[model samples]
Target: MFSNPFTPIFGGKPDVFFGRDKILELFELAMFERGSDERLMFITGTRGFGKTALLEQMSIRAMKKRKVIDLGPDDTVEQFITELCGYDEVVKTVSPQANLNILGVGGGVSGGSISKAKHIGREKLQPLLLDFCSKNKQGLLVTIDEIQKVSLEDVSSICNAFQMASRKGYDIMFAAAGLPYSYDKIVQHTGCSYLRRSVHEEIGLFTWDEASDALNEMFSGIKGLQIDQSYLDEINKFSYGHPYIMQLLGYHLILCINENKPKARHTVSEVELKKAEQNTLLAYQHRALKPLLDEFSGQERKYLMKMSECLDSNRLTATSDIAKALGTTQNKLSKVRETLIAHGIIAAPERGKVMFCVPYLADYVKQEAVNSSVISVARQRGV
Candidate 1:
């Protein structure tokens, strides 16, 4: 039996990832080009848009010529420096003659304590990285994922370190991925204001061609299973160019076929495709939409529900109509409107119209609202 190649997991890079050629090109330029301002990059997008995957891929490329440091939301700048200095590979690259432990600590190098290094501020860390780059003749790559969860103070500190290192002509590169709100916050910080000059990339849905090509490639070479062009088109339309949903649809479609006969050659039928589509929607609702909706505040959810109520046949709801439905003026809805737009949950298509950024999201919101109301009624009636 052939394994399913589609992966719906967030940040999970499939065996054959596609549709990011331009971004990867930019990343390569950043990694190799000296004095390139693109060395600092900020990637922002909605959930499941492959921001983390992109970062991971860039890190893989960077590792060929640089010491890559991975940071998380809870990591402070001091911790980052400590980890970098303590990394065995970094230490070996910098000082090849030094005999160090696995962590590059506790050897013949000034007591070799990571705890001692942790207390060093940017003033000390910058020189260390500069020295390493000077010796290894390579740069440093620091990748931070989920930037929105990081604190402004920590962001300031990290950016300061990079800025100081870059000022000394050290080949230091920084890449961060986060939601729009987090990106906005970083841009607004005075200490890291230099990021405003860095390359800002907004990740969006895959193009129709990109999505179709991905599906075709994933379905190719599977034993005894052939998907017709019409079925492929249907899957693409149902995915609506959303990368994660496309993966889900492909995954479920394969499962739908294999459930009947795991090891047999079979032509996929329209009926099987339809069932796969249904299962994909259900999986998306639970795995993606529900959690995304749960992150909204009461007021944000209210705005979404009202917009869902006003959705037209084209799936676009006028901002004024949403305000009217909420019994508020458009001015009063500005905050929620901007918030949703920043979160990539909705887009202002025109001067007066807004739409769910994800296809079928409006329908999901409506269904969720109905389910909530039903549960409320049940609880009130003690059912």
Candidate 2:
């Protein structure tokens, strides 16, 4: 059996990760620049827009000339410093003649050694990193994923430490990825003001051409499968340029076609395509829509349900129409609109017209509304 070529899950980098060449180039340039502000970047997008994948790719690129450190929301400054100081390269750079082990000391450095290093204060750790970077002639690339989950105090401490290193002419870079709400929170912090200068990149929808090319490439090497142009067109339209949806549709379509015939050349039919579409829709409802809706506030959810109700045949609704549906003036709804737009949930197609940024989300919202009513009725009847 031929293995599936597409990666349909979040954070899984495909063998051919397409449609991000421009951003990758920008990151590469930053990696080579010693003190460029571009080295610090903040990437924001809705869930499944490939923020984590992009960060992973950037880390891979930076590893050639710099030490790369990966941090998460729960990581503390002490843990980070201990990890950094224990690196073999950092130890060699900082104490060339000390015969230090992996823990920055001799006698085969143990867990206790790292524990002690973790207690080392910021005042001391800062100079230690500077000496290491200065001696090794290589910078450090620190990437923090899910920035929103990290506390403000930890963020401030990390930023201050990097700022101190920058002042002393040591090369250091910071890159973080998060949803728009989290990214906004980080920027709003007064102590972490240095982030204000970092380049902000918003991941947007992919072009049809990019999607088609990726699908074509994924199908090319398969021995006994050929997809029709019409099928590809349907998949592209169904996916609506969201990367995760594209993978989902492709995965389901392949399975739909290959289910009866284990190994044979086959041309996809409308029946098979429709079956795949149904499966993909169900998968998306549970995997994407339900969790996404849980993240919104009550008012935001109300506003989105109103907008979904107002969707036209073309999948777009006027802002005025949505406002009227919500029984509010457009001015009153402006902040909610802005919030949704910033989080990549919805987009303005033109003046006065708005649509869900993720394709098919409006339908999902409507389905949720129906489900909610059913639940309410069931509770009332004590069923």
Candidate 3:
């Protein structure tokens, strides 16, 4: 069985391991220097790059000296405040008031979900957090995961809550993690003017050596398992060191080893492992990639196809070359860059370098382009 060493190392935050040491170190430094203006550290990364795992790790670290409130994605301000105020505890601890102004259950109020979150505003939520911090009398760390899913109004309220708690001598801190664009999304949503004073951190991929070591460490923990360096190198190459892929490959290798018992000396055969990896990758591509392709428009699909063709040269393309390949103006391509980014298809790593977020999709695109060309040649011959 694949023991999932990353789970224990990351504490089941999901998609958060294999890399991100520098960011983690900086985060700890920020926490140590708590009460500074940069108490709110927003960690951002691509999908499956382990943003949640980092937050869960932080939550575990904070649990030693602070209280943790795991905020859901769609929680309203009222719901948030109630949770923050320990409403569950209050109903169980304090007066038996049956007439509490609950928003949803039994329809006690007259506001929609958005309205409900806005209702708490800065005033109501602020006091509850302040009181909680005052009573706890220890460092309070409110780590919000998937914070991007929360509405702009709610995000603003969260930023405001941090500001209010900090001003009141409350040893409170905030750590939020989300996608690469989440920081800008928060800033745009929360225009509370205080966010400008917060710190930001970006978590990126692992280096080749780091990724190799991680795979070795991960495999060594599994009982009756001993993978050779050659097999490990092949797995790393196929996975591109993506954390989720690393886990998925690890999971499948264990299954293969257990099944192919004849050749299961100490490690599984690479040939069977490759087949299993292909199957797993196909399933993932079906689930994630096909849907994204279906959502693309004719022009967008063309642009992506061009990107694949250009990137497959194993070389990066300039915007001008990308424009020529797509037969579109650079301005039009520029306009759609944000859309492609939002759709999570491609990313510009540096100012001038662009590549597919999922390299397999680029491969798929290349195959499809070849198929289309072959079909065109057949039609020409028939004519």
Candidate 4:
């Protein structure tokens, strides 16, 4: 029996990663061309849109020609310098004692011995970074994932430093991934003004062709498992090319096909496919959609609930209907629409229309709405 080929873990680098060849090509070109405008790339998207996975992929390629350092989402500007302290080039400029302390300092401390040794403020992050970059002839690639989770102030402090470093034309590159909302907020900040010019890559839904090719390649190696166009069509339709859903459906479908049988026909059955679909939807509701709902504001939630009411068979909703239901003008809802679009929750397919970008969002909204009504009625009845 073949081990499950689908990688469902968030940010887990899949063995058969696909649909990002164009992006990888662009990044490689940026690396090869000195002072290329595209060196600083920011990938943004909703949860599980493959931002973190893409960052990991870039780090793998960047390591071959440069010093690559990956900073976790919570790591602030201070941590960036502390990471620099571990390097020989930067250590030469600082006291030897600081080098020993850098590794041992905990979260309570800010900057540790490196901060005391250099007396450098967090805003001056570029100087040490530049020094390190100057020494590295092959250049340095700094990749950070989920940057939107950090405070904008912390983000800007580092952005200002990076902007200065980039202006100086040092051998340095910064690639970051985060929710799309932060891109506008960060760029508008005075401290991160320079980031307005940086590259923005949205790791979004895959095309049908991209999704089909990926699924075909993923299952092709399994001798005991067999799939054809019909299975592929069902999986693609249900997943809608969302990377996370694609993985989830593919994983569950494989399990359903086998059904713990000692031996069975490799071909997929309708019963198995239906079971997989049910499992995928349940998993999506809890694992994927719940966190997103938590992030929604009251108004945003209301907007979505209202939109869900107006959903057509095609999954599209009219902006006019939403505005009318909300007792607001379309102009008033424009900002909400823009926010939803940025969040990857909805798309405006054409003039005066918006569509839920994720599969089953409409059904989820309806269920939540019904539950809310039940709670409201119980409260009134004092049951």
Candidate with best TM-score? 1
Residues 79-148, model 3: lDDT tens digits: 6676675434443432333333333333233222223222333356777787778788767777777777
What would the per-residue lDDT of candidate 2 be over residues 1-383, giving only the tens digit for each residue?
A: 44566677876666556677788887888777765667899998889888888888888888887888888778556667766666443433433234334335344343323333333444456666676678766778888888888889888888877888888877788899998777778888997888988989888678999888776777776777777887888888888888888888878877887776655666668988899899998998899888888988887888898999988999788999988888889999999889888778988988998888876778788888888999999999999
Which pairs clash in the backbone of model 4?
none
Which ranges of candidate 3 are over 4 A from the true structure?
1-18, 35-38, 88-122, 262-265, 291-298, 341-345, 349-353, 367-383
Decoy 4 TM-score against native: 0.86
Q: What digit string (tens of lDDT, one per residue) describes model 1 on residues 45-158?
A: 998888888888888899988888888877556568666566544433434345445333454443233323234344456666666667766678888998888888778877
In the range 295-335, model 4's lDDT, one tens digit per residue, is 88888988999999988887788999999999999999898
On the 0 to 100 scale, the lDDT of residue 207 in model 1 is 84
* Every model's TM-score: 0.88, 0.85, 0.80, 0.86
The full ranking of all candidates by lDDT, starting with the best, is 1, 4, 2, 3
Candidate lDDT values, in order? 0.79, 0.78, 0.67, 0.79
Output the worst ten-in-a-row residue range by lDDT, candidate 2.
110-119
lDDT of 1: 0.79
C-alpha-based local distance difference test score of model 3: 0.67
* TM-score rank order: 1, 4, 2, 3
- What candidate 1 gets wrong by more than 4 Å, as runs, is 87-124, 221-224
Comparing 1 and 4 on TM-score, the stronger one: 1
User: Candidate 1 — number of clashing residue pairs?
Assistant: 1
Lowest summed-lDDT stretch of 10 residues in model 4? 106-115
